[model samples]
Every structure is written in C-alpha cells, then in structure tokens.
Target: MPEITVVKVERVAGEQGQAGRVVHIERPEEWAACPECGVISTSVRQRRTTRPRDLPYGEEALHVRWHKRQFACKEALCSRKAFTESVAEIPPRARVTGRLCRAAARRVASGASVAAACREYRLGWPLTHRHFTALADAVLAEPEPVEVLGIDETRRGRARWRKNADGSWDKLERFETNFVDLSGTGGLLGQAAGRTGSAVEGWLDARGQAWKSAVQVVAIDPATCYRTAIRRALPHATIVVDHFHLIALANKAVTAVRQRVTRDQRGRRGRSVDPEWANRRRLLRARENLSQRAFTTMWNALIDHEPTGQILTAWIAKEDLRSLLACARQQQPRSVISHRLFRFFSWCAGSDIPELISLAETIEQWWPETLAFITTGITNARTEGTNRLIKDAARVAFGFRNLANQRRRVRLACTHQTINPAA
Candidate 1:
C-alpha cells in the first residue's frame, strides 16, 4: 500500500505446520531523518516485532509480521534521544492498519453493521468503530449554506417517569432535533439534543451569523419553541408552517369534538356499536378517500343515532379548513385565498362550536406562517423523509445508547459518502 513508506515485503509464505500465509515485512536499512533536529540518524537504539492487522486476503486471514526499530539521534548537538519509526498506514501505537479500517468502514457505509465488520476484520469493536468514525470524519462535508432549511424532532430514547421528592412524577422525554437542507443535497445538516428553544438556538448560534443570514426560509411544524428560536436566530427567514400539520390539527379538533359530544350525550365513552365510534376514522379521512355509499352510510347512522350535531359541525369545519388549504395549490391568488379564508371563517363563526372556534383561533394565530406556506409552497416533506431514514439507521443497529456515536452513524447513513476514496 502507498501508505507504507519504509516497509518492504520480504516474504509471503506459509510457515511449516501453520494454517495461514505469513507475510514478513521490514524497514529498509537507510539513514532516517531526525524528526526534531532535522539531522540524519544511523545509530541503532533497539528493535522489536509487531503484527499489525490488515485487510483479509482470499479465503484465509493473512498474518503480517513487521520488524521495526527505534533509532538514536546521530546529531550530538541536538537535544537528542530515540524514537520509533512509523508509516502512514501504521501510525504510532496503532494496532490495526489504516487500509483495514477503510475497508471495514466502507462496508459499514454500504449498510454493514460494525459487528459484521469486526467479524470480517477479526478486530475488536472499539478499534473497528474508531476506524469507521475516522473514515467518516474525513468524508463528512461541512454544512453548506442553503436558502431553505427544515427542522424536525425525533425520539432519542425511551420515555421515563421519574418521581419527585413530593411524590409527583415528572416525565423525562429524550429527543433530538434534526436540521435538514431543503434546497440543497445536504440531506441532514446536523442534529442537536433536546427539543427546547435553547437547544435550537444553540445549534444555530454555532453556525455563525454568516451561515444563519444566508437562510431565507425555514419550514417547520407549529411548535412555538421552534418559532421562537428561529426568530431569535434568523429574523429574516420566512417561517412556513407545514400544511400537513395544519390538516392534522383540523383532524385532531374533529376527534376532540366527537369525544366531547359522545361523553356529554351518553355520560360515557362511545362503544364500537355507537355511530360516532364507528365513523371516527372516516371523519379524520379526506373527503376524496371515502366513497359516496360509505359517506351516506356514516351520515345516516350519525344523524339517526345522535340528536346533537356537534360531530357534524366539527367535520364540516375540518372540510372548510381543507378547502382553505387547497387554495394554496391554486397559485395562491389573493382573491381566491381571501374567499376561501372567508368561507372557512364563516363556517367556524356560524357554528360557534368551541372546538371549531379554537381551530379558527389557531389558524388566525399562525396566519402569517400559513400565508408563507401558501406563497412559497415549501413543505417539511424532505425533513420528514430524512427522519424516516434516521429511524431506519437506528433500527439497523437495534438502538444506540451513546448519542455521539449514534449521531455519527446517522450522519453517515443519511448523507453517505458518494465520492470515491483515494488509495
């Protein structure tokens, strides 16, 4: 290998009665330069033998025996002592050769587990993983500036409840916030622990003002903390709330209204026989997904079984909100958006149902962000897809207990190195 500068392949043969091929190697007898004094050294200090592991060859593992030395400084005037020689492939104190690490890490980048790499290389887990990380550290690129960035969170660990001194239990939720490049090929930029505003701001602050200023828009869910952090860190960036989240909120409002109506009317939860329970999933579905017969069946059943029309009101409000969102795809004409928004507001206002009213208030609260979504039509779909890949990486390893290693593996998995490695 080019990484080995001084070593020569002296012999490659199977020893008597040995099972595998043994490759004996040694440094050439030449004057070596003194590392500190810049003088040549010829005095011999000591000699030792090392067997650094290398990539497997053929069916059996090849054994490498390297005969190396420590040389005494030839310069008398230098503050000279002795030092061991090293090559690029075998750094000082490295037991596993560099090329072996690259081969194992390449396997990992191609979806092989670290344990599988370890078995193939016949190396320890720590050494194999360190090599994997070294290759990744060399390969991972810097976060490039992008016009649009998407932010989302995923669970970092299992949820737990810790009891306080006063006998109250506090939830301990672990999460990691993922920042994605929405306008570029950088699938995942970076990740930060926790889902708090401080966590978001801390990561942004490290990117420096120049990087933050280049970001013109950010797509995210309707998390107040995320918005607060973005405003503090990127004041110029237009925040576009994902339209999917708003639709989910509308569905959530429908469910809340149905549950409240059922409890109030029957003084208990709805059973499977109840029309409200039967139509629960249908109410959350988009209008296009249901057939006319199915819709008619649900309508007749709910109308006949329930005297109060609260569930119907919530469903109508949901459809109105959907129609309003659909205007975003109509090129967001001002007149069209105003008409749709007015119609949705009129429906919510006419019903005066607490659930529908609350949904309207939420729409009004995030109206500017909603307008940004309509105008730009940028969604957090990329970030959502990246989150799936991230979760898949977690599953491939079963799970990760250490956050740092997990992030390394995830970053490697999400934005795998495409460029060929130099030998």
Candidate 2:
C-alpha cells in the first residue's frame, strides 16, 4: 500500500477569511474485497468527494476532503455491487475523522461540560454529546473489582410530593446511593434508586458472590440502612464508620446543647450581638486549629456569663470527641485509644446533657465499627470527593432530570477512562 498524504491545500474563497485549512488528502492504492463473497477487486467503478472535520491544525480549524474511490465487486454470485473505502484514521460514513472524535471525547471526559467541549472543539452539541455518551458507555460498562467499598447517599434534588390522606400534599425526601470502589483512586461502582437497604442490596447482589467475596471492607456513615444492606450483602467484609460522620455527630450534639441552653438562659434564640452566637463557628472549629489565647478568652467569657454550665460542658464534650478521633489516628497503642475512649464515655455520662448522652449511646452501639475504622485506616473521604464532583457536574449542567445519563456522566468522570474502546 502507498503512503497517503495531503496532496493539495486551497484557501476557501469567501467574504471573510475563515480561520481554517482545507486540505485535499490522497487515498492509498489498496485492493478492496467484496464483503459478500470475500473476492478481491481492482476495478474502480466511481469516485466520490467528501469533506469531514479533522483535528485542528495549530490554532486553525481543519477540514479534510478526500476523493474516495468506490470499487466494483467482480464475484459473479456476490449480491453487493459496490462499496466505499475506509481507513483507520477516517471510518466509513463518519462525518468526522477518528482522531477528531477521540479528541472531543477526551475533552468531555476530562471535566469539560458538553457545551464547553463543543464550543472549544467547534462541534455542535448533538455531535459532542454523542461522542461523550459513546465514550462513557465504552469506559464504564464493567466496573473494576472493589476491595474496599464506600457507600453513601446524596440529595439529588428537593423532596418529592405525594397526596396525603386528607387530600393534602406531603413531601418525601429523595436520595441516591453511590457505591464507590475505594481500593484505588475511587471509581463509582454504581448508583441505586434510593438510600434504602433494599436498594443497596439489590445493586450488590447483582455483582454476584464473587464480587462480594472479594470485598474486604465497606465504609459508610452511621446509617442503619447501610449497615443492614452491607451485613446482608457482604457479611464477611468489615464495616468501618467514617470518622468525618462521627465528628459531624459530635458537632450536631454541640449545636443542640447550645440551642437548648440559649433558649433557657436568654429566653429566646441567640442574636448576632450575643457572644456565644457570634462565636458559633469558633465553637465548632477544632481546638488544634484555634488560637489558644483567642479560644481561651472566648471560652472563659461564654462560661462566666451564662448561669448554666451546660454550654461549657457541651463544648468540652465536643472537644473530647474530636480528641478521641485524633488519638485514634495517632501511632499510639490500641490500649491508649481504648483508655481515652472510656474517659470520653465517662465524661459524656456525667455531663448531664441529653444530646451528649444520646451521642455517646450511638457511639457505643457502633463502637466495633469505629474501632475497625481506626485499625483499618479506611474512610469514605474518597467517596465524598466523588460526590462533590457529581454535584458540581449537575450544577454545571443546570441539573439532570435523566438519572441514567447523569449516572453515565458521573461514572465517566470518576473513572476517567473509556468503557468501550470500539466506541
């Protein structure tokens, strides 16, 4: 076969000089075969001209025009009369060259929105979207095996409405469960309809026992639904409670105590001028991150002014909980963590704050999982990062009503690979 090259270049004659190059390319002299009878033919029945988009030449756009030859099939019994020539660079019947399609797909998969990719690539939305969908489908068809799975839920939209018993409308919270493979730079395994146990179990069960057996750990927030599903689907896998969720719970308890104490002491909700209200964010911040003198001054003032010591106690309890997590992450012995945790539990029990007591009990119930988290050093931080990307994509797209397409886009984005090479 002869080497093909650009044989001619012409300036497009128009009112304005367009920023592009129109290159006439030569076709390789190769024998064509009849598809029906597999007979080789050398006859050129006709020649046709076609212009297809190609990869940009520098900053300028590229237009590829090829004089494609049609060959006549010589086999007597062959049903086909003629067929057009195709090459790896430019497939048959395609409006764009293979390289251009790949470039567009790469741009879209690399975090650029379809509209942005289309604009930058000088392609229409429909064409760009087609390439993106094809790339996503090819790349995300069979997910990688998951060893450490992370399950979490995110609010996709507002609550759905349903007719109530009295003809009134009731709102039901809508959620989607994301299954992430945390064994590597996390890729989304799948997304289910809702955050229910059944939804999670169904998705897991579909992966079969081989996948379930391969899973070593499953990390999740302290959600009972997720616990139930993981227990049923991956019974052997250790469930590790995410440390961030534990800290969030502690913050919630602190907030609850503050609200209750404020209502009782101030006779109303806290105002901007109030010291505690003004330093609300300071109260939630980790002690290590806060300036010692500033934190001490605020702490002393808030505790001294309030007649009830509940606020101070709540703050201490919150700090103690944070300290417990910090200690768990340290290279200390397990006995040290156990001792500190016991102290934290005792403090919570004596604190007399209902919120703290409740939090302590919840922690006690999930103590094994918490300990597993400390030992295994696994968390849902990756899954949370993936969730943020999913939300960002949705925000950029002005929100997605079609869950299937949204899932595809997310899988493509998270995996950063093509599922189908043929596409």
Candidate 3:
C-alpha cells in the first residue's frame, strides 16, 4: 500500500458488511498564518475533527478523519479573527478529498452521466457536477488557434412548436451550429443556438481578432447563413464548399427526378413491383462501384421499358456531376477540371431537366468555392466526426436539455481528458 501524505492508514472494521479503511490525517506544520493579516502566529485557538470521504481502497471505501486546528492573529491592529487550517489534499468546506472529487469527474468526462458517476463514487450529484464543470473550464480556457476551420450544424432534437393566435402550432428548427478546428487539435471550438448567420457570427465575433486572423480556410455546406457569417467574421479566409454536401445535393436531385418520373408515368407512387423503384438504390450508387452486369441491366430497364427518357437523362446528369466530383478528388490540373465542368454544364443545358438545370445553376453560383475545395482537399469531415461524438455524449446523458452542461461535457470529451484523479 502506497503512503498518503499527512495521513496514517489502518484497516478498519467493516461497516454494513462492507470492507473499509480509516485514515487519520493532521496538518503537519506547528505554526500557521492568519488569513486576513500578514502575521505568522503560533497561538492555537481551537481544534476539531472532520471525517471526509477519500479515494476508495480496492473494494473497500476509505474515509479520512482530519484533525484540524485554528490559530489566532497576533498583529495588534489586525481585524482580529481566527481561521481554520486547510490542507492541499482536501479543499476547505469540502466533504471529499480532491482525488475523490477528480475521480468522480473523470467518470462523467468518460461518458458516464452525472447521476451515474455520483452513485458509483458514493457521492452527491451537486459535488460531482461541480468537479466536472471545473475540469471542462480548465480545458476550454486555452484553445489552440485554428488554421482550417469547419462549420456545420447538427440536429439537436425535433423542432420546437409554439401556439399561434389561431391555436395552431408553428414549428421552429432545433439545431446547434458547431465550430471545429480542423487544422489544430481537431476539437470543437464552440457551439451556438441556431444554424443562423447571426448565431454563427456571434460565436466567431466573440473569439476576437487573433483567432479570426489565424483562420486561413473554412469548409462548410452551401448554406447562405454560414457563408454570410464566415464572410463577416473571417473575410480574408478562403471558403471551400464540402464535397460530400455537394454530392448529397446531386443525389437528392436524382431521387426527386426518379420519383417525379414514376408518378408521371404510372399515375401513382412507385410500388415494390416497379423495376425503377425496386432498383432505386442501384441507380444512386456510384457508376464505378456497380458490377458490369448490374449496370447493363439497370440501363436496359431504364431505356427500353420506361416510356419517357427523363429518368435516364437525369441519371446521366447525376453521373456527370459525380464524375466531376471524382475528378476534383483526384487533384487533376485546374485546366482539366475546368474542361470537365464545361462539359457538365453543356450536358445539363441540353438535358432540359429542370432538376439538372437548377443543380447546374447552383454549381455555377458556388464554382469558386468548389475550386477552392479541389485545390485544398480540405473538407468538414473532422467537423462531422466531432458532431457524432457530441451526439453520442448527449445520447449517453439521455439528452442535455441544459445547453451549458452539454457544451462543457462536449469539451471534455473532445479533449480526451479523464475527470479521474488517476488520469
């Protein structure tokens, strides 16, 4: 058994049929200073004992009996009062040792709920929560400067509703914008209430000039809200539209065109029997990933059986967009990508599909941002991963109705720090 400072340890009789140990600890110094005065005094005023919880001893609980003393101030003009002694192992007015408190906090930081950590450590909820908060505060105070930042929003829960004058409820988006440092520690920088320009801008603005100037690039979805905020908060930083988001938009367009064609031709929603409906997933899969036979079968069904070629045209446009994205990923020369983009736009214009046309216009609108992504090869992948962790922590806590607590826990989790004293 390792020795504990200022304490004498011994085996004690079990309580309630449980094994336990008792520690007798006392202040080692014979003299103390009066807190309010600059005088060092040796006059003993009073003595008392306190039993505070300590770290567990194996399967047994350990309790420390601290023999404390108070000394009176000897300064003649002192505001005359006596103060109790304090030790480094335990804070004043605390019922548990510092190590014990840290242990409880570590559990919470490692994904245990506050309630569960309290129960596991045989401590109260309030004390455990305080320790957890302190640990999070220490970690968040010195965030590393970000060079490449990623901004995105995660759905916190279902939309909130408020009753209107007509007794109807209006739904509002329930989201939290997460700012992540992709080029630094890969930890989340901050979270805001909504996915709005003001919410994001406010968080960035609060970071001050130094942090904003350190940012060289930002990866984000093609949302005007985020674009506005990034422009205002970090005007000099280049913006890269996330490749995954752009591909997802193209996929959505393809699905819409398929559904529209299905309805127009059959005069009803697609059923399981419809070949296009049944192989819908195959249609969305990347062309390179599809097997030769499967690809031929799908194309034959779309071309021969389908009366209108709208779905086929839409599929071709979707493939062309995917090829463009793939070309970007390959880091091909700018001229090569430019040639591909030209061909993509020409195809979209000739297809005459409204969905493809709209997609082309959106691509044109964000063309510079897309090129930035191709050149930099930076994406919001890290931000998406961090969001997953935040969501997992929330799920473990059974939903953080209190945003403050949620943010603290997320900080601790992302930094990979244990609340435990052993850590």
Candidate 4:
C-alpha cells in the first residue's frame, strides 16, 4: 500500500471477502498541490472516493480502494479550481495502475495470448494489446547493420483471389520477404511487403546507404528476382546461393526423371508395386544416412526396374551435388570440388535425360553463386529457421489479417530477450 506513496493501509479485516483483501487504504496528513495554479489550499473540499485497479498478487484479484486528496486552488487568477492528486504511477482518469498495465502487457509480450492475459489480469483485450504495443515500441530498436544478411520470403497468409475480367481468379500478394541477421543473432532483422525486386530494393533503400554498405554478404535461395534485387540494392555484397535450395532443386529433378522414366517404360504412372515408386523416398536420402542393407536393396531395385538407367543416373547426379555442397564442412578433400563438379556435369551430360540436362544447366547458371557458397560458406538456413518461427506465430494467432500488427508482434518476439519485455 505504501508503494502508492500517497496511500497507506489504515486497517485489515480478519475475514476474507470475495474480492480478497478489505484493508482500509488512506494517506495520513496527505498534501496535494493544485494542478491549475500550483497553489496549496488549506481549505478542505468534499472528499472524492474511487477504486483503482491493481496487479493480481494472489490466486484472487485484490480490491484496492485508493484514498487520496483533492485540492481546491487558492489562487484567484487560476482557471482550474480543484484537482485530484495524481502520480506517474497512476495517471488521472486511469482505471488501472501503470505497473498493472505493464504486467499484463508483459504477459502477452512473453508469448501468452491476449485472451490468456485478459483472463489472468482481468483486463480487456484492447487495453492489453495497446500496452503491449507501447512496451514493444519503447524497447525494440531499428535493426543494426549485419555482416551476413539472409533473405527469404514467407507466405503472409492464405492467398486471396479476385475474379478477373476473363472470369479467372488470380492470387493477391501472398508473401513477405524476411531479412535476417545470420551472423549476429540469427534473429529476423526486418520484412517488406512483397517478394519482388522492388520490395527488396525498397526495404534496402530504407535502411540507408551506410547500412547497405556494411552488409558484406547476403545468403538467399537461387531466385532471379532476389538476385536482381540484391545487385541493385547492395551491388558490393556477395550473394551466396543457399545449398539447401540447390540440393532441393537437385532432388526435384531426380523425382521428375523417375516419373518420366516410369511413364515411358511402363506406359503408366508408377504404381505402389513398382520398385521405382516404392524406393522413391530412398532416392532423396543422403548415402551416409542409409544403411548398407537398405542401400543395396534400392540399388538392386533400380538396376532391375530402371533398365534405361536414367532414373539411377539422376539419383547419382543428386548425390554428387549433395557431396559438392558437403565440401563446406571439410577442408579441400583429395576429391577436389572441381573433380566433384566435373563428375556431376559428366553424369548429367552422358545421361541424355532432359530433366538431368535441365538441372545441369540451372546448376551451371548458378555456378558463380554456388562458388560463393563454397568460399564464404554462408547459407539461408538461419533465415529458413526464422521463417518457421514467423509461421508458428501466425499459426498460433490463427493468421493475422493486419500485416502491421503481424509484423509488430513477430518483430517484438524475435528481437527482445525472452525475459525482458519492458524497458
């Protein structure tokens, strides 16, 4: 009760009430100056009583009866005659104490839902959310310049469609590009509206030239739009094509080749009984992850069922690409990267499969960025992880209709330490 400064516990009841405490709260010999003319009046006006909301300190909510003074201005020239005493802790016309509001906001800032906080603190959703946004704004700073920035796009929400003049529906903006500080804290740095070059460029432009200049390298998937964006925005920064996306591309090519081979050889789509379809998942697994028994089983099945050997060749090509990517974790091996690249290219050339050839050409097109990956070893793996965090927040919230609020919540959660939600 002394925490309020102006108030003291006058008495306490022996019995517990439904509202918990029934302690009499008042300030002894309290003095409050007039807010209008800053004059203290000795005259006592009629007493005004009010019940202020406080933080929930126990299983039940506390019934706080705040007894404070109201002063009548003595100055004749003052426009305002009377005013009640107010402190920074409890502003005038405020129902809830400042500390109580902060506690409620902190509950939501720590990842609890607004409804949960409302239930616990007996606060309305608007009050809790407003306090939370204020707290977040007070603590969260602009993202600092990053050495390695990871760029990737996450879906904003479910796609929206509108019927066109031709009666076909088209998707509205569905993605937001996420910028992450890969080298700093592996937390999300910021985001932009869409995934286009302009969106990326606009975000980078807003960061200013000095911040852009500080970015030495950027890690991203092999998307031409993103590549073009980075070139225009941060031309000096090296763009490292993430190995995960490259490997995924290779695996997709393998799937394509397998389906084509099955269609041509068997004159139908792959069935569950077919060895190629049965061992489909095994084809994507890294050789190190597969036991010798499983490896030999799949190898034999491919040999017997895939007589043209295109599917097998495609699988080998994917493995070679994986091995090439794995070079980042080791020193220059006896089997050099050039040697690995040569073998992958040679396999793709000799296979005579259009899928394999297309994969090889794509790899060739991205060879420079691929080399950038080998040298700097930067990857958007952290960005992808952050994307999952973003998606989880959205999923928990049942998807945000407002992008600003979505960014505010996610940015606060990502930037602040799990413990500190208040300044």
Best by lDDT: 1
- Global local distance difference test of model 1: 0.85
TM-score result, candidate 2: 0.87
Poorest stretch of ten by lDDT in candidate 1:
3-12
Clashing pairs in 4: none
Model 2: per-residue lDDT, tens digit, 1-423? 133567798766433665666889867666776767878888999899898777776655567788888999887788888888777777779777766777787787777788887887778888888877887776667665778999999888777799988999977656889999888754877888888999999998888888789999999999998998899888899999999999999888888888888888779999997777877888888888899887987788787777777777888888887777776568567888888798889999998789999999999999899889878778899999989988887777777777887888777777645434334
Which scores higher on TM-score, 1 or 3?
3
Candidates in order, TM-scores: namely: 0.79, 0.87, 0.84, 0.90
lDDT of 3 by residue, 119-204 (tens): 88899988899988887787666566789989999988667799999999988768889888888674887788888999988988
Q: All candidates' lDDT scores?
A: 0.85, 0.82, 0.83, 0.83
Tens-digit lDDT track of model 1 for 310-407: 88888988998888888778786888898889989989989879888989999999999998999888999999998998888888788887888889
Q: After superposition, how far is residue 214 of candidate 1 from its true place, in Å?
A: 0.9
Cα-based lDDT at residue 154, candidate 3: 90
Identify the runs in model 3 with alpha carbons over 4 angstroms from their true place: 1-18, 23-50, 63-86, 91-93, 142-144, 161-173, 415-423
Residue clash pairs of candidate 1: none
